[model samples]
Target: MLLGMRDDEEMGRITLAQVAERAGVSISTVSKVLNGRQDVAAPTRVKVERLLEAHAYRRTTRSAREAPLIEIVFHELESIWAMELIRGVENVAKAHNAGVVLTESGTRHAPGPEWMEAMLQRRPLGVVLVFSTLPTEVKQQLRSRSIPFVIIDPAGDPDPDVPSVGSANWNGGLAATRHLIEHGHRRIGIVTGPEDMLCSRARLDGYRSAMTMAGLEVDPDLILFGDFHVEGGYDRATEMLSRPHPPTAIFAGSDLQALGVLEAARAHGLRVPQDLSVVGYDDVSIARWASPALTTVHQPLRRMAEEATQMLMRLRAEEPVSTRLELATSLIVRKSTASAPTGSPAGRGGARS
Candidate 1:
């Protein structure tokens, strides 16, 4: 048996000295790699990581000096749902007496390498990521250190190997569209999120499904993909409103986009509900305070975050957890949506053949 090494039934009996020898590196180098030190050469780190993984190595020891922290990383901190997610993580972290660390880095796909290096060094209790996917190396490094992670994937797309928390995006979309249809709006338009995101596609599919079920002819021109931002919403709404026979109602994929649609309607001299009804998704705070309070789908952002943080704790405890947890989405009706205008092309009686 090697010094400071003990047999772990689950982690297997791999000693640090054995790993160092196989990787052609000193035991100290292997230790640095395990601790996520950036001073080691790239080749050496990769070799050590492979050996550790091959040996099914797990770091069972915890440093007494380590801080109790729960880290949450996001690609964009400016998102409207960011505060809700933060609040959720904070709620759980506070309960466990662990501090929460927020980091904004990387793209929609994954966090940056620098962030990874820093995170490994910090050695937080676990991690909660808002990204849809994580790189394989990042996953391996975290596993090698026995660090747990859960993805708060609002995009509704997550890597197969990683655990995740997401809402019913497709159901949200369907509910939003069905609400419009029930209000006698037949010529409805949809402005969903970016085409590349699975969440966007899922919502769009929901919209299509609702329209089909209502016996409404879905005009391809009325469907637009947005950036889930006010600008994209405004631009898309403007394009759709300018058409010869525009939609009598529009469903903006997000609250931010809904605000843009409201502005677009105002610019076109259309009275909401009376002239053109509007609906939005993700009932963020702004949705309620809009000129005509938005009728939107209440995506449980905070709850999703809470569940994700809880999952991280479960993982840390080596408890069995579901690979994917999907929560339900409900619609909140307000002043923005109403019956279609009597004079509109697809008014109350305008069910498509």
Candidate 2:
């Protein structure tokens, strides 16, 4: 439709009204008939179809396409954080006067060598993978085909040699947990990310490291697993809270999980910070307004994304690039955490360690 297409000034572009006038029919009649609106008379549909072919107006939009297109492929389209990641990719791509072809992997049909071959044949400016959902074989196929690409959340050994970027999630977990510990809390709990995700594993390691460093006993019973989602967090939180001796300070690996924990807290009639201290990773926008402002670890989302895509552009320009980029993570201390209750499992009631 001309409404969503490009046009040339010199062509004296035809208008729908003109088409209607030329066709000797009312504007609505032409639109309904041409659009197959189902409300048009059978004879009117035939006349509009004929007139459309005669005008050769099929290609309604026109534009001077100058920039080259770069393919930005994501592992999955439905991930909660993919949109922000995409916006970051688009920011750099558009700034450099390049186009972006967004596609995905991990569906009913897995990617294969043939798909990689087709993508290589196009010779895109570069490939930016938001995440690696494809199998190792597919990745190797892309590499062997000499395709240029960078990994954001790279999957297994996702070309340790190529430029890769992501949140410093391990440090995020450390910071989140350390904040609770520093506030005189000992019974700290952790909700881990997916077992297969290196990010989640790193975060879990950080949590254990922080606990070990503080000389606090890491109770395996206090740790749970979630898939980095609100619902997962909700389920895990409910399950953990059902325990006879629940933790005094719970650290969720993501903001959504933290939200789920908040709901779970309400379900159990536990007030945040008053009865339980909570912390979350990923200081998303909603973290600010949660019942008690969330004390979360902040992932440098905009900067990380900007830097990653910018690195992709640099690679396209034949510039030498580093293979690994580690961004810093920080704690955004808010209202959700407080000193451990006098009788809480944290050290308040225990003998000196």
Worst 10 residues of 2 by lDDT: 58-67
lDDT leader: 1
What TM-score does prediction 1 earn? Answer: 0.92
lDDT at residue 199 of model 2 (Cα atoms) = 78
Model 1 spans > 4 angstroms off:
1-13, 344-353
**Residue 53 of model 2: what lDDT?**
51
Per-candidate count of clashing residue pairs (backbone under 3 Å): 0, 4
Model 2 TM-score (2 dp): 0.71
Give TM-scores for every candidate, taking all chains together and pairing residue i with residue i: 0.92, 0.71
Give lDDT tens digits, candidate 2, residues 1-353: 22223442355545557768887888888655433255777677566656555543433422132136667766577665666777777788789787777777544224433345445445565677765444554444343223457777622223465578776777887888888889888888888788877778888889999999999999999888788788888788877777776778899988889989898888877778787888988787778889898998888765666778887677545576777777888999998999887763632322211
